[model samples]
Target: DYHLLGGGDSKEVYVGWNHVQQIEIAWNQIVYYEDDEKLFTEEATLLKSLNHERIIKCCHYWFDSESKILNTITELFSSGSLKKYIHNGVGVDLVSIKNWGRQILQGLCFLHSQSPKIIHRDIKCDNVFVASDGKQFGLAVCIMDGDFVKEKEPKCTPEFMAPMCLLEMVTGEYPYMKCSNQMHIFKKVYTGVKPVSLGNVKDYRVRDIIEKCILPMSVRPSAEELLKDPFFLYNGRSSTFETCAPVDNILTSRAMNIKHLYLV
Candidate 1:
């Protein structure tokens, strides 16, 4: 049986067994609008065609014409989203954070490298999933029908939006969290002010990455370029077992010592 995972305005996520193997899927029940159907179909097709290690895998999809419901089967990350992972205060060392950032950037690079160039307009912590093995998985919400154009004023969570989308408005509040309204948030975004979260980040490299992502549309670094940044590099050495063994042993010994002290 499929158990409820969570839901948003458009769809619900569920976890269940795929015959013998356990799997998770997202199910969207279309309201039967012709345009909505077309858009959903297109998104399904696009998702199926996309295959990348950092991007969520869409295994299959089925549409029930009679019920007007669309079902999409995707890989389930039991560890949940990055936002939740951080909030839980689990495995959040600098190394893990950097690894997650690199993976996310790689996923973005793949999408942007596509022939038509898919822009993940909504890039936020909540949209990034974490696997048990500490890998990051990005959720892509495709923007259809020229929504990126200025006239449409695409709807997005202000906190995660790029500054160009907000017309360079600067704000002291974190993106979207402090704004009284969308227009207020828009003005703040237009002024090119850094979000409160970015301002509070103590790590220069992490802060730099966030700044690059929210730069004015014309000058923002592409995901490909961001991948090449020194922040992702690790002392020009492979992170192989031989290189990490000594450090790992030290850490393990320290942990054991702490445990023994506590027991005593």
Candidate 2:
């Protein structure tokens, strides 16, 4: 067995490559495309199309017959997944997390705005990769497993799940009943400890967006909804997403009662 260096998800390992004889269907796909289907090929091509300092690049892909597995040969790096970094005595540095979050959101916005929105369905720390070096200045993580899809019988993770998603699993649970505010989220992240405290928050617009993202009672924003705002923009250049959150116009009147949860 070869010891591959890497990080993992439910379908992958902490580090390394797995060989398969053919393509294993993505666990979350509603159904695999027919033999002549081009969805997978199309996505691979799209991944190849995007390149940015903060985006995770798709290195290569191949299918094996004997083992029945398809593989993506990615650019190997010394840094691991964001989860590892957080676990190894790494506190979430606000600025770094902000940069990483902005890049990812920009990627997501691009994906969602496409003909058919590509729901990351699964987004969390582990699915994000850390930059190879410290000098990158930005946390520079990218959307890993970008080509993944759901199966007829899909499985999901709970930890990073939007609560409404928890309900979709047929495990009836109560949704959050209150309107969430920014401080409410700080409490969750702080988790019983003193608040990390914000400094010069107005100076970091990228951060304000992320803080909006992790709010416990907050609902996930749609690419369309973001576009409706004069703030969030697709300027066609720059790494960080642009925003002007007219505080009154930015935060939507959704979440807490999270309506639609699962994509599949």
Candidate 3:
């Protein structure tokens, strides 16, 4: 019901790609069916006012008191969510996942940077959509399911829960002692120091930012904070995202040169 409007329930996506040109979403929850239509119209109108690449752009909306229905439309993405792709024997690889992680952060950064600010509380693989060519290897994660997103105090998910969650759960003391929800986890992670339980992502850049994003706020990382992140580096026959690929010999040369330079 909620997902289809703009981002229909995760299960509803792809039910009928051709049936609708754009999906509508409500800015707030609808407790009454009578108000559902109006909610979609109003929220869609608001979202349409903003612009960003990763966000599923809202198109238009209208109120139909006669039919007791509200209408809103948005860009139609034929490709489905990353969750859908993962369900069909295509688990996101390290490279693609890293790119996705980067893009998700980018989208969040864009929203959080807004004058008022917007936060996608439910950030997960299922909520993220892929382009129609989602299978095309190299596209970053596309954020969808904005209906559940909020501009103020946000709702947070437990899974994909940031590290501070684990830390607070484990340590359970001041600072994070009262922490709850995943965003708190992210806030703690933004500090730069690693949260105890997390492991490293394969991509150096991604891993670094994840650590940065989760870094405690005292040392928060910004979107402009650049690391040596690779876009698409290839070596031999297999791409980096590929499961099997040859290692580059040049790394040894570079390492040796650095060693000599340091010694001097």
Q: Candidate 1, residues 1-264: lDDT per residue as tens digits? A: 777776544445577667756455544332334445765666678777888988877778777777666777777778876655554534344465556667777887787677656656555565667787755566544322212223234455554556221111111123545567877877777787665545445545555666776778688876677668786765332221111001111000000110011100
Give candidate 2 misplaced runs (Cα > 4 Å). Answer: 1-3, 6-46, 49-52, 135-154, 163-220, 223-264
Model 2 Cα lDDT, one tens digit per residue, 113-143: 5445444544444455556674231122222
Which parts of model 3 have CA positions greater than 4 angstroms off? 1-42, 64-70, 135-154, 158-207, 226-264
Residue ranges of candidate 1 with Cα displaced over 4 Å: 20-32, 136-152, 163-176, 235-264
Q: What would the per-residue lDDT of candidate 3 be over residues 32-104, giving only the tens digit for each residue?
A: 2454454444445556676778776655545456654344344544565554455455533455544555565
Which 10 residues in a row give candidate 3 its minimum summed lDDT? 250-259
TM-score of each: 0.74, 0.47, 0.50
Worst 10 residues of 1 by lDDT: 250-259
| Best prediction by lDDT | 1
TM-score attained by model 3: 0.50
Model 2 has a clash total of 20
Task: Judge candidate 3 at residue 165 and give its lDDT.
Answer: 19
